[model samples]
Target: MDESYYKYHLFFCVNTRSDGGPCCGDSSAPQLRDYAKQRIGELGDAIPGNVRVNTAGCMNRCAEGPVLVIYPEAVWYRYQNRADIDEIITEHLCNGRPVSRLRI
Candidate 1:
């Protein structure tokens, strides 16, 4: 099989609903997404292949706001804070192991 374009492509949903509704942006997805990007930048070559963290519009999983999806594997995860972001980076992105507890 061919290698993935980016070993891990992370898409963080940062959409905020017009009316009152649960949304990733309202749940701090942007901030956490930035944090994840910074952390990955710091990791540099320590991580395999190229990892791209991007901001995405609504994934329609509003009830599960603050959601992030990793490509190639298409693993979805819901995170609360920086610590959870750290866990994802360390375990999944770095170690090639998905964090079962965070899977959504």
Candidate 2:
């Protein structure tokens, strides 16, 4: 068996909007997910066997828009941009503390 370091897995809800209702697509889900992946790699913590950034179909929190859920802990977040994603990566992913300001 291979060893893994990351204790958390994050998933962004990139569900699209077709009915003109609210959804992650209407916000910054794509950007956030991309930013997260990049940041993780840049931090040298993006081991495919440990941490993974994935796109989810729907988290059922469309109203929140740009929703991301961290697993192995299952913390949901609502973000607005790169800064929020950064905070999550730094505070939550790296430091093991959830960013209460962005919790959803």
Candidate 3:
């Protein structure tokens, strides 16, 4: 991998349940993940391989629900919808500053 990149990676937990436990996909994991991936793709292409966005199993933070983690920076976030995901991508991933309002 190229060292010019900041080595940032974001992982979204997409756990689901029939019994109703807290999960990232519980509210809108698929939508969020899709949005995240698409937004990252849109944003990262400008930088060309600086960040990686991915799907995860549980992230062991189900209690927090709708959780996502960014590595190297190790920032954790809880989001409600596509708008939040978009903000994260625009304000944090693209700008090098974390979205403090959404951090969890």
Clashes of each: 0, 0, 0
Question: How many clashes would you count in candidate 1?
Answer: 0
Runs in model 2 lying further than 4 Å from the true structure? 1-6, 45-49
Q: How should the candidates be ordered by lDDT, best one leading? A: 1, 2, 3
Which candidate has the top score in TM-score?
1
lDDT of 2 by residue, 58-78 (tens): 878988878889987889999
lDDT (C-alpha) at residue 17 in model 3: 69
* Candidate 2 least-lDDT 10 residues: 43-52
Residue lDDT tens for model 1, 45-81: 8888999999999998889778999998989999999
Which has the higher TM-score value, candidate number 1 or candidate number 3?
A: 1
User: Which residue pairs show collisions in model 1?
Assistant: none
Question: Model 2 reaches what TM-score against the true structure?
Answer: 0.87
lDDT of 3 by residue, 14-55 (tens): 888667877676778877888888777776555434777788
RMSD of 2: 2.8
Better of 2 and 3 by lDDT: 2
> After TM-score superposition, what is the CA distance of residue 100 in candidate 1 from its true location, in Å?
0.8
Kindly indicate the candidate among 1 and 2 with the higher lDDT.
Answer: 1
Whole-model lDDT per candidate = 0.92, 0.83, 0.80
Q: Clash pairs of candidate 3? A: none
